[model samples]
Target: MEVRAQLASVFHLDKCLGCHTCSVVCKNLWTDRKGSEHMWWNNVETRPGTGYPPLWEDQQRHHGGWVLAGGELRLRLGSRPHVLDQLFQPPTLPTLDDQYEPWTYRYGDLLGADPTKDLPTARPVSAITGRPIDPSAGPNWDDDLGGSAVHAAADPNLAALDPDERQALLAFDRLVFFHLPRTCNHCLNPACAAACPSGAIYKRGEDGIVVLAKERCRGWRMCVPACPYKKTFHSWLEGKSEKCIGCYPRLESGDAPACFHACTGRIRYQGVLLYDADAAARAARAPDERLVDAFRDALLDPADPDVAAEAARAGLGEAVLAAARRSPVDRFVRDWELALPLHPEFRTLPMVFYVPPLSPVRAVRSDGARPVSDDLLADPAALRIPIRYLASLFAAGNERVVVDALQALAAVRAHRRARTAGDVTAADAARLLLEAGLDEATADAIHRLTVFPTLRERVVHPPLAREGEADRDPGIQGLVGLRRRVTS
Candidate 1:
């Protein structure tokens, strides 16, 4: 049991309001610079639509993540020798069009144009070239199911569904969609770190936050394709690669990441997770269908004595262990089993998990009139968003696990509604909870954490002990801390 402490997160998709506050705040803080315009370190994409880089989930084209071969995991891009050979020009690298040409409108045209001219207006122009251009795409081009026929129809996850199911889902009357906020998973087995030829990307030993050192980066841009999530990007002007740092500078000072702080929906939860390193390795190598279970098995109980002893041996401080014990992420993912990893088949061992959204109940039309199903609130099996679709996204095509999670979430809702609304009877709620393999106390606990987590409860991390390290160098210390504050 090679226990190690890692920072992890859970996003409750049901609560996400799709307000884009998290994305805007993250942009202003991190990627708002020349050559970084195309980089959205945090982006919210709509489901049933191609993501930012347009078809990024189509690993067949991007050649990202990892692949299992002969019971061993290897980079989908290729082996080290193959990667080195293509160092100069990566054949699978996504073009600027694929990522959308960053654009801006010429506001000066509107200001300076003749007053008599026919309704002076700003003209769209490329942010990169400063030339007139017709804007067609953007980071969230398919937001709210925009151009659904074209963009939403091309969703890669829909490949798992039968043709009949696909057609029914895309039908005019049954269209369904949800917001998917994304960031670097800060994976336990980081493909970006593994594919970096210059060794610029590395996970921090203390907290497991992946950092791409600008000084060490050679600008090979291998990390771009290697990152299955497409979170890594190249800085054309600076000749460096940049990615979400998980706001480490703030974290070391005991604050949450900017996105988490700015989130409008309060859907984000961050905390410490204790996992067995060896178990994580084995889990990553498990067959596709078993990946979710294997991944969950890899996470150790923070309160377990044996796990604590191993974590101590691995140099985890008491503070970190305590945080792990109180982690809301652990409760959602491990204790209640309501949250699951996104695309576990990618084999990145992502630390970020999601509580999949519960869609509207499927209804039927009778004699030109529609009636909601009687089991609208009871049967999650009547999910409007096909279980297979969500399974592809989170459970590596394992419908059973996805069904289990959705059922548990339904039980929580049922239990709460019974208590508050008086519409559902106590016996009915108990029966539903029992069917979902949950007791009343456990259901209430899950409900409380999901619906009413405090700021400290949502984001939990121990002191990083960076002050002593930062004190070693006054120049760096002055930048990272308040050492140079003018306090006469």
Candidate 2:
């Protein structure tokens, strides 16, 4: 059990209100530079839509991640020969057309305009070019427009649904979308790191945060198409590949990433996760349906005496172990089984997990009115959003797991509502909660973590010994601190 620590994240989709505060703050802080107009390091994509890069989940087009070849794992993108050929001319790479040509308003027209008969209007112009733009698409262009056949119909996840289900999913009233805020997963099995021919990308040993060295980068766009999540992007202006660093600089100083800090919904949770290095390959190689469970199996119990001994032997400091024990991410993902990784079939072993949203049961709620289906509030029927759709996103097409998770979430809500709303009897709540394998205490705990986590509660930074880093040579301290591995 070769224990190691990774910086893991959990986003409670249940609490996300589709507010773009996370995106806005991330843009303002990091990707606001030239050649990054279309790059959204943190983006909130609406479900039932094609997402930011337009059909990013269509691995058939992207040809990213890995595949079984001769009973061995190999990059689905290609081997070295194919990679060299596709370097300068990456046909599979997403162009500005796919991820819309970014535009900004000619704000000078509005802010500094001469008095005229017509209203002072700012025309939308290409952020890249000085010419006027039509503003055809944007980061959240498909937001709340899941009913549009042009947008939602093109969703790749819809492939899992039958023709009839697909049609209904695109229907106006049937369209109930959820927010999927995405960033670089900083995967345990990082395909981007492996695909970078320049070997610029490397995962930190201490925290598992994947980083790309600008100087070593050879300007090859291979990593872009190779990342299944499309998190890696080439900056035309900088001649380098860039991605979310998980705000490592801030993290070393005991601060959360800008997006996590600025999140209005308080849906983001960050913490340490202890896991076995030996399990990553097997977990990634698991059958698609079992990938989520395999990944969870990779994460060893931090509180386990045997696991703790392995951690100590593997050089994990006491502080990290403590953080792992207290990790809400561990509770949500492993203990309570409330959260799941997105697109586990991608096989990148993404560190970030999501607590799937529980859509409101289809019913009217008036004063002294009873719910149409008490089973929905207690037993969790696919009332608003189809369970199959969510299963595609999170469970690698495992509807059974999605059903169980949704049922568990519903049980928590039912337990709470009975006490607060008197909509159901205590017996009803207890029965449902028991059916879902939860008690009131556990339900309350899950509810608190999902809804009202404080900054300290949400972000649990393991003590990175920075005192000695400060005492190092000031000129090279930054380099020294970064290059220092966990084994060092």
**lDDT by candidate, in order shown:** 0.85, 0.80
The residue-by-residue lDDT of candidate 1 on 110-176, one tens digit each, is 8888768488889888888999999788898889999999999999999999997888788887888
Cα lDDT of candidate 2 equals 0.80
Q: What is the overall TM-score of model 2 with all chains considered together?
A: 0.91
Question: Can you write out model 2's per-residue Cα lDDT over 199-236, one digit (the tens) per residue?
Answer: 89988754778888888999887889899999888786
* Model 1 clash tally, residue pairs: 0
RMSD of each candidate relative to the true structure: 5.2, 4.1
Considering every candidate listed, which one attains the maximal TM-score?
Answer: 1
Once fitted onto the true fold, the runs of candidate 1 whose alpha carbons sit more than 4 angstroms away are: 365-374, 467-488
lDDT winner among the candidates? Answer: 1
Q: Quote each prediction's TM-score.
A: 0.94, 0.91
